[model samples]
Structures are given as C-alpha cells and as structure tokens.
Target: MRVKKDTSISLFYDMVELMERLRGKDGCPWDKEQNHVTLKPYLVEETYEVIDAIDSGIPDKLKEELADLFLQIIFHCQIAREKKEFDINDVMKLCLDKMMRRHPHVFGDSTASTSEEVVQQWEAIKKQEKGYEERKSAVDGLPKHLPALQKAQKVQKKAAKVGFDWKDINDVIAKVEEEMEEVKEAIAKKETKDMEEEIGDLLFSVVNLSRFLQFDTENILHKTIYKFVDRFKKIEKELASCGKDIEQCSIEELDALWNKVKMNARKNI
Candidate 1:
C-alpha cells in the first residue's frame, strides 16, 4: 500500500515518452523500423518470461519481466500513433472503461458477492458488448496463436459453458482411453499421417480430462517435460562419470540407469 500511495505517475509517462522518442525520425533505426507485426515474437517471448518469473516465485524478476511485456504494449501504441491511429491514452482509457463497466458490483448497483458470480456477470456483460455480438460460436474469440494445449482447454471450457460436455468424470476418462486405443491401432498400421492425427486426438482427450479435474493442462505438461529433461541430464552425468557415452551404451544399460534415477527421484520426494 505504501508503494501504491507513493508511486510517481510521471515514471509511466517518462517510459511512454522514451518509447515515442525511440520511434521518432531521429530515433533508433531499429525501433523506427518495427511495427506491430514485426514485434509479435518479442511480445510472445516477454509473456513467457513473465510466466517463468512467476513460476520461479521471484517478485523482482516478475516486475522486470512485466516491464518488458509493457514495453511491447508501448511499442505497438507508438507505432499506431505514428500511423495517425490511437495513442497510449486511448489504450488506457479503453481499459479503464472496460474495468469500470465489467465490475458493476463496485461501480454500479449490481451485486456479486462471490468470485464465481463475478465471472458469470463479466461474461454476461461481455456478450452484450458491440464487438462480441458478431461471434458465431462460444469459442470464437480464443486467439489462434495460443499453444495447442491451452487452446484445447479453452475450447473445452467454452463448450462446457453451454452444457455440451461430458456429464460424468467416468465418461471423460473413457474418452481418453478410447483415444489411446485408436492411437495404438494407428501405430500398428504403419501410416504416418494416421499416427500423427491419432496422437493429436489422444492429446486433445488428455487435455479434456485435465480440464475436468480442474488442472491447467499446459502447466502440468510443462512440469512433466522439465522433469524428463532433469532425469535425462542426470543420466548423461552418470555416464560421464564412467567415461562412457549414452549412445555407446546398450538399451539394457540405459534402462538400468533410468530405473535407478527414477527410484532416487521417488525417494527424494
């Protein structure tokens, strides 16, 4: 609260002004060359960096990553201003108006005492917005650029909202098992495209199961991927101790090491 009370608003404007200067006639050549399209990768990369900082549980790292993400927003706004479109003020005003409009419990007479009720209210209000009226499907607004796992989960969530979902957790589990069987059959056929498509279906079913259990599929997959990498690196380190290459080892040897490392991981837990 002290930080909020003592925060200087001028710092924000200063950063905005710096971005403008960077994109000006005599400013940085690279900055002047960038448009919203060219800076898309940086925006996505900075977003992940912010997520990483949060996962690391480091406040200072999160603050720095957030600033990097904010720079992407400022960069796009500056480019728009140069093209005679809206500026940062318009962006801030629109966001302010959106929050004020969405949270009617605080800004108006509407009442929502719980978080779930607030989300329902927000979605209801969103459907009444001008741009949202044209959406042909409940899942239409999800960004195409989202990771496949996240996109699948979001699509399932939209469908669930309209009661187009499995009525029981057992049904969800059954769907996953059914997909797995199809995947194995596809692999047995030795058809590459069929195998790929079946694997995708299997993954989509797993994402649905994760959603039913109220877990974030993308985050859970990330944890599994990192765990695999950690154990593999340990295997490589063990091989280095014996002055032998993993590639030179027999499958049986590698499997022996793998079981040992897996056992150690469980014991540590």
Candidate 2:
C-alpha cells in the first residue's frame, strides 16, 4: 500500500519505498547501477547545495535542499539494506543511541552548567567511547579530505582541548606575522616549495587567529569573495558609463575607477 503524505514519518517511509522501487530490477538502470562509491559525489554535492540554500536565506529553497540531502541519506541506507548490512531503521537507532549516550547531562545524572562545559564533556565522552587510550593521537579522528581551513581549525581545536593552544591571542597574531616574514623570505629566494609551505603556514596561523576571535575562517573568506565579485561588477558598470570597458582602461585609470566604486559602496553602507 502507498503511504499517505499526511505526516513526516509517513513521508519519510514513502521516500524509502520510492528508493527501493527505483533500485528494483524493473526500475531505473542508472539507479540500479549506482553503488556507495558511485553515489559519493552526489552525497557531497547535495550537502553543499543545502549549505548554499541556507546561505541564500530563502526558506523554501532551504527546505527543498534539505529534502534533497535527506534523499541521499535514504538512498545510502537503501543500498546498505540491499547488501544486508543495515537499513534506515538501524541508522536512526544508532544515531539516537549515540546522542543519548553523549548527552549525559540531559539524559542521565551528569551535570553541565555551562555551554562550554557541555562541549568539553561531550568531547570527553566521545574520546572515551572511541577508546582514547588506544588512539595514537588526539587528531586521529579528523577526516583527511576535510577542507583545508576547516581541517586546520579542527586540528587546532582538538589540540587546544588538551591544553596545547596559545595562552594569548597576541601570540597567535605574532605567529601570523612570523609566517608572513618567512613567506617574503621564500619569495626573495625564489624557492617554490618553501613559498608554498610558508603560505600554508601563514594561512594556518590565520585560521587559528580567526578561531581565537570566535570567527569562522571559511565563512569570512566566502563573504570576502562575494564582496569582491559584487564590487567588480559595479566597477564594470561604472566604466561602461564613461564609454570605456575594463580592458580599454590603463592601469591608473582602472585603479581610479576601483577607488570610485569603493567610495560609492562605503557611501551606501
């Protein structure tokens, strides 16, 4: 029988059943051919689409993107079920059990008075659950493929929890400056590998500074890129107003136009 879309639970089961039908022998050849490896890209794509939708600040778009992401989860669960590994129910059960285990302050007798304490307790519990004694390092659990900025932040955070962080934000700032100087030295020596390594160190220090300041480095860079693109388009429009284009302008002329755009942007702000 077809499940009615009257409730969220029913809708979820409907999605699961739909995936099952799609992977059946008489169903989609493309869908049937897909395995966990083949679907990895789609999983990543849908997750980023959901992030983009949230960034767009559109409720309907976010809702649609969330559904798409959820579909990827259900599809993966269906594949696992086909292989007799696990299904959606098992997935949900494991997550629920883990949550209940992790949140001892909420679900058990443990007490966590502050959000910071709660976070610390959660990490402690997670480390214990993962057998901290057997792990080689605190950084062992970090995924290798995480984005560089995020990975740097995570590695720093993990180390910080174990008292490996700088005692002062000023120290982090000094490290950034030291890295910048090394980068300049590498450039003067014309060493490609040294320059690359110094640049990475500079960025890593900057990531630490951002975290110390309670900021997100990736989101900060994303906003900066958006601002640059927006201002560049305005520069293009202003140049066209004078019957000139960016390519037709001299370097000084282009710089003057860029200044005018920046002034206009500040005025609007």
Candidate 3:
C-alpha cells in the first residue's frame, strides 16, 4: 500500500489521490466498500474527536484529529468521484463560491460596521441563496439530528433575533420558575405523560435561562458530566482503599462517601 510521492503536487491534492487509491480495486477491501451513507458515523465521530482534542489542550492531538476528519471528507469525495457524481475540486469550488457570496462586506459593496451586522447580512444572503425563502419559519434551517440542547439554543436564538423572546433576564428567570412549578404539580399527579412533558418544558426553560446568561447549555452540561465522573471515580478509589466494592455499599454509605469526595475535591481546588 505505497503511494508514489509527487513533489510538484500540493499536500491536499496528494491526500485526495491517496483516498482514490484506497477506494480503487487494488486497494483495501474495507475502504473500497464504504459509501457516504456507511461512512456517516465516522464523519461525526472524527468531528467530535477533533473537538475533544481541542478541549484537551493538545495541539498535536488536535492536528491528528483534524486530519482524521479531513480524511472523512476525502473519503466521501472519492466515493462521489467513483460514481461520476462530483469530485474534490467541485467541493472546494462550491465552498469558495459560498464563502465569497456570504461575505459581501469583504468581497462586495455591502458595509458592515460590526460582527452582528455581518452575521445578519450573511443570514439574509444565505436565506436567499439556499431556498429558505419558501420556508414558513426562521428556525427551519436547523438539522433534525442536532442534539436536543443545541437545537433548543439555535431555535431560541433565531426567534430572539426577530424579537420573539422575553423582555429581560428577569423575565427568563421567571419563566424558568414557572416551568419548575408546573413540573412539581405534574409530579404530584403521578401521571407519566404529564410528568415527562413538564420535565421537558422545565429543561427548555433552563436552556433559555442559560442562553440569557450568555452560557451554552450543551457545554455547561458537558462540564458537569465530566465533574460527576471525576468525583465518582474518586469515591470508587476511596472504597477500594477500604477493601469495599461500590455495589456492596448501602445508599447512606454511598452518600457519605460522595460527601467525602466532594470535600476532598474542594480542598484540592
């Protein structure tokens, strides 16, 4: 599986050629069998790996993950080339055209004094170019597969841009409290369906509150999950030191160990 290096070609072009070879008849069976649909999960997985590397604060890891993500792009382009659909050049050309068209402030006569103005102008241009004019709502552009929290934030932002949001931060806080009360009432009724709906409403209101406070719900939730995992592992370590297993511990014992773990964490902080 050796590729002849061509010094005159750009690195990106070489990579694309390498991908074509991998999908060729003489290449790896696994690579040759993958289509865009079958490779979708790898595309998503590599994207998150890139984000994780960035979060890890490792430049080398980030670079490696980015290359993995780029390989997915090349993989798809090679598949498209095989089917005589389109190729890498067409992909780059369309991307370049899209960027040029979207940035009228830089490429055209349109003037934007601020980032917000630039974003507004870009959205307007995107709507016109992407057939969004036929859509009934501004929030129609978000993908259905987007995470629930991120979807909430995007739709809320779209609506807020058109002044369909709470008047102030206090209003958002009040709405969250109202939702919480409804959730409590639903719990008292003990109906599963009502409880589920109320819980969702409460979560949505909390996402709104986070948005109003200029915090991303998705990111904050990720941080909280990491914290939980770290602290729980510490509790497990303490139990192991005492020759005890977590599953053998009572609820009260676990609660005490959790408190000790939190105390130790605070001390370290």
Candidate 4:
C-alpha cells in the first residue's frame, strides 16, 4: 500500500515555484545572490521587527512582519536546495516528527498533568532525541551567537534548571548588590579588565533576577532603550525649537531639557 502524504501538496508546489522564480536567471539580483551567511543580519532584523510589531499591538503590522520572517526561512531553504541539500519539505517533516516525539502525553502513554510537568518531559525527550550525553550541562546547547542580554538570560535559566540557582528573589537581590559592590571595587582600583568582568557579572546577576521575577531580560532592556530614545528625541525637538542643536547645547542645558522631557512624558502617561 502507498503511504499517504500529510500536507497540502499544492501549497508545497507553490512554494517550490516561488523559490525557483527567486533564484532564476531573470529573478531579483539581490535575492538570487543571497546565501545563508549574507542573510544572517536580515534574519535577525526581521525577528526583532516581528517582536516590535507584536509589542505595538498592531495585528496588520504583526502579520506583515511575520511574513517577512517566513520569507527568510524560505530563502534559506531555497539556498539549501541549490546545493542539493534538503529543502523546505524536509524542514517541515523534521519539525513535525520532532513535535510528535516530544509530546508523548498527546501521542503516547507518558502522562503529564500540568504545564510544568509537560515542560520537564519535553526537555527530557529533547535530550534523549538529540543523544545529549549525560555530562552535557543544561547550558551546553545555548548558542554563542545569541545577543549578550539573551545569552545571559539563557545561561541563567540553564543554571536554574540544574538547581544551581538562587534560593529566592531575596537571594538574587542580595547577589545583585554583591555584584554591584565588586563593580565599584574594580572601578576604585582603576583596573579596566576587572571593571569589565565585574560589570558582566552584575549584568548576569540581573538576568538571573529577571528570571526569578518572570521577566524577559532582553525585552525589558529593549523597552528601556525605546523609552530612552523617545525621551532623547523629545529633548532634541525642544532644542531645535530654541534654534540650538544638541552639539551646541551645554551639558547643563541638555540635562534640563532631559528633565523637562521626562516630566512631560510622565504627565502625559
């Protein structure tokens, strides 16, 4: 008996056509020339743009941004096909298989009564399927290429998973204070390397605190930076209204403008 395929054949064929058109001789030069390495920045940018669109709470923009991210996946698949490697179909199949294997509560006899139990089982199944050695720490699989803030969070979570974590939020808070003290000590010693290391430790401890408090450290930092940019832009506009550019403003004048913007922002909020 012939085995029946599980997905939409027409849609798969359409994706194939689209990929071929993009890589064809008459296709867009940039799309045809792009490879995995060249598309790395674009993949990262699209991911963040999607996140921003989601945070903006605009469904239309979120849809468009998600489409852009999907396009990157397709683009990468097209490049792989050109090299005679697996294509999009292989990717879909592998993902489906992995999901089915991981979700034994749904697909097999393994029992999971809560989301927490499901997560623990999923992690166990993932390790088993990946043939991860017993000696492999939970942090072993974290990608080094991740952004520093995200990497710090992932490292903290992995350590937490293995019980090598603070006892409570209070413990993390105390650790943060200790790390800050070390940072100050390094600053007082005037040792650049020590200061840098202490600063990193402080940031890492903060990431741990974020984890305990159920916050995404990366997202928190992003939101803080967005607020800063908005306030700084207000300051710039205020300066421009007075026929003064930022470069022409004295430090005192800028500080006053910044304070004004902060007060106005809080008032509006």
The candidate that wins on TM-score is 1
| TM-score versus the correct structure, for each prediction | 0.96, 0.94, 0.93, 0.89
Off by over 4 Å in 3: 1-9
lDDT of 2 by residue, 10-105 (tens): 878899999999999888999999999999899889988998999999999999999999988999999999999999999999999999999999
What TM-score does prediction 3 earn?
Answer: 0.93
TM-score of 2: 0.94
Per-residue lDDT, model 3, residue 219, is 90
User: After superposing candidate 4, which stretches have Cα over 4 Å from the reference?
Assistant: 1-9
Ranking by lDDT: 1, 2, 3, 4
1-269 per-residue lDDT for model 3 (tens digits): 56556653578888988988888879899998889999988988998899899999999999999999989998998898889999988999999999999998899999999988999898788778856777788777888888899999988999898888888988998999999999999999999999999999999999999998889999999999999999899999889999999999999999998998889889988
lDDT of 1 by residue, 102-131 (tens): 999999999999999998999999999989
Tens digits of per-residue lDDT, candidate 4, 1-269, equal 56446555776577778878989899989888899999999999999899889999999999999988988898899899899998888999999998899899999999999999999998888777645774466678777689988888888888888888878789889999999999999999999999999999998888888989989998898889999999998888877888888998899988988898899888998
Which residue pairs collide, candidate 1? none
lDDT of 1 at 25: 79
Stretches off by above 4 angstroms in model 2 are: 1-6, 130-134
- In model 2, the Cα lDDT at residue 226 comes to 94
lDDT of model 1 at position 159: 93
Clashes of 1: 0
